[model samples]
Target: MNDMLQVARREIKTGFRNPWAYSFLILFCVFSLCLLVINSQSIVQGYSGVTGSMLSLILYLLPLMTLFLGSFSLTAEKEEGSWQLLSTYPIGSLSFIVGKYIGLSIVLLTIVAFGYGLMGVISGLVGMSFDSTTYVLFIAFSCGLVLLFLTLALLIGSLSKNRWQALTVSVSIWFFAVIGWQTILISVLNFLPYTWIKPTLVALTFINPAELVRLFVVIKLGGGSILGPEYYQWVDWIQRSSGSWLFIAVCMLWISFSIMVVYWLWERGRSHG
Candidate 1:
């Protein structure tokens, strides 16, 4: 535990010292602030309008930020032979991985909070009304999504031989999750029988963290009115079956599974070489 904290602290310090970290911070703040300012004037439905807009934006940006941040975190160290030096020490690989994950998660969470909190402050100054419960839920969902992507990034980093390889994989994943996932799902649906479409879509949603987060946020915010009638039925079924809890469980499983893969790969490589 103590070793993990030390590793986490070092990772946190390294992240804050990096120039790109600040760039990410600035990008998130600027985008979030701009969105808040633009919507402040037309916030008709209290927090729903703003929250919905912010969720859409986050669904696009957060994955990109996390993928790059996570992909670079360990790969750069490996390229510099830092891990070799650390291996000479008493720290176990599991501790190192867990520590790095915790540290990066804290850094990402801080950036996310700053971006969202800045918007909240700006919205308050402009007298935009928002429901506290909905606002909190949005923040929670966003944070959970960030952590999810960070774990994935770390897994990719652990499996890659160099920073460039890690980065390439990271960007490809971001593209698939943020942009290509829906198109792929649509194509798959076109080939499936009508009876299997809904269940398949629901199963697909569980497979993609992005979709899981979107479903949770939409259901919690009561934004189903904007969805098509077929989706509404799907959402209703999900809600009735406590799908939100299941989603949360799946996210937890993803994180654990990712960490285990990282550990297994790292150990295998070390044993073979």
Candidate 2:
């Protein structure tokens, strides 16, 4: 436990010192403030077009930012031989990875919070009305994006042999997960039987954290109807009293499963070579 905390503290220090961290920080802050432009439009109740667009904007940016930041940090350790040095210590792989996760989560979440906070403050100064509930939910959505996607980033980092490899895989994943998921899902589902589509879609939704979190947040915002009529039944079930809890359960499962895989892979690499 002490070793894990030490690793965590070390990650925190290095994460902030990394220049890529600050570059992402600046980009997110600039993009976040652009929400004011969308706010200029009239607000409709319940996940207004304005808010929905904002959600999409955030979905596009945060996951990639997280993937790059997390992946590069891991890959750099390997490339610089720091990971080899760390392995020489008494600490285990689980402790090191979990510690990195803990520290990176803090660093990324802080950037997320600061970006939104700056946006809120600027909007206030400009006399724009951003709803408190909506503000809170969007922040939650962004934080969820950061936390969930960071796991994926760590996994990519673990798999990559170098920063270049990590960067390539990260972009590929961000493209497929965030940008191309819907089209690919539709095309692939067509090959399945009619009876299989619904369940398959549900299963696939859980496979990608980006889709899962976005869908849950949309439902929580009472905008599930915008997902189109095909999702009506599933969305209805999720809107039930315990639906959010169910979503939370899936998220917990995803984190556990992914972390286990990452740790398993890392420990395997350590053993093999």
Candidate 3:
């Protein structure tokens, strides 16, 4: 546990030292702020009332940044031969992975929280109101999504041999996860026979976490009064739909399988050598 904490601290310190990470965070925050300003008018018109939309935006989009950071995490160390040094230490792989995850999540969460504040400013400008409970739920949802994305990114990082390969895989995964499903859904609708459309959509969406998050959020925002009795429904929907438990279950399955695959590949590479 102590070792993991130390490793996590090292990862966090290294991340802070990296110029690209800081630059990316700044740029993302700036762009999100711009979007909030533009949407402020919509809020006044009652079209943009989701209290957590800004934070949610940051949570969804931060996957790209998280991917880049995480993919580079181990691959860069490996390329520099630093991973060899760590391996020689009294460090466990699980400690290394979990530590890096914690450290990086802290950094990402800070950036998203800042975005949430920027969002609150937009809400105020638009004259929309949200009580304390809604604010908590929004933050909780954002945290869960951020962890889910970063975990996948870390797994990709562990698998790649070099920074470039890691980056390619991470970005490709992000592209497919974020946009590929939508494209597939559209194609299924337009090209497939009518009978197959709904089934295709259901299968694609049911398995796709991104779509689930969006679906859950849209329904929550549109289906209730922000400050009224129906607020519990929105809260309940978010809690269930945040998919934290499901995501953790999926990640555990993914990691267990991934570790087996990586070990097999490692053994094969050694045998070949």
**The candidate that achieves the highest lDDT relative to the unseen native structure:** 2
Ranking of all candidate structures by their TM-score, best first: 2, 1, 3
Tens-place lDDT per residue, model 3, 1-273, is: 998899889988998888867787787678656655655454322215444455445544666777888778867876898767877788766676667778888877877687678767777776755454445555555655666667666667666888889888977877777757667666667987867765666566545555545445444444334433423543454557554466457545644554454445434533453
Q: Which residue pairs in model 3 clash with each other?
A: none
- TM per candidate: 0.89, 0.95, 0.70
Off by over 4 Å in 3: 42-60, 118-141, 186-207, 223-273
Q: What is the C-alpha lDDT of each candidate?
A: 0.82, 0.88, 0.64
The alpha-carbon lDDT assigned to residue 114 of candidate 2 equals 91
Q: What is the lDDT of candidate 2?
A: 0.88
The global Cα lDDT (0 to 1) of model 3 is 0.64
Q: Model 2 over residues 1-273: C-alpha lDDT tens digits?
A: 888899889999999998988999999898987876778565424576777888899999999999999999899999999999988889999998889999999999989989989988888798778777777878878988888898899999999999999999999999999999999999999999989988998889888889988887887788887798768875887889988678778777888788888999999999997
Backbone clashes in model 1, listed as residue pairs: none
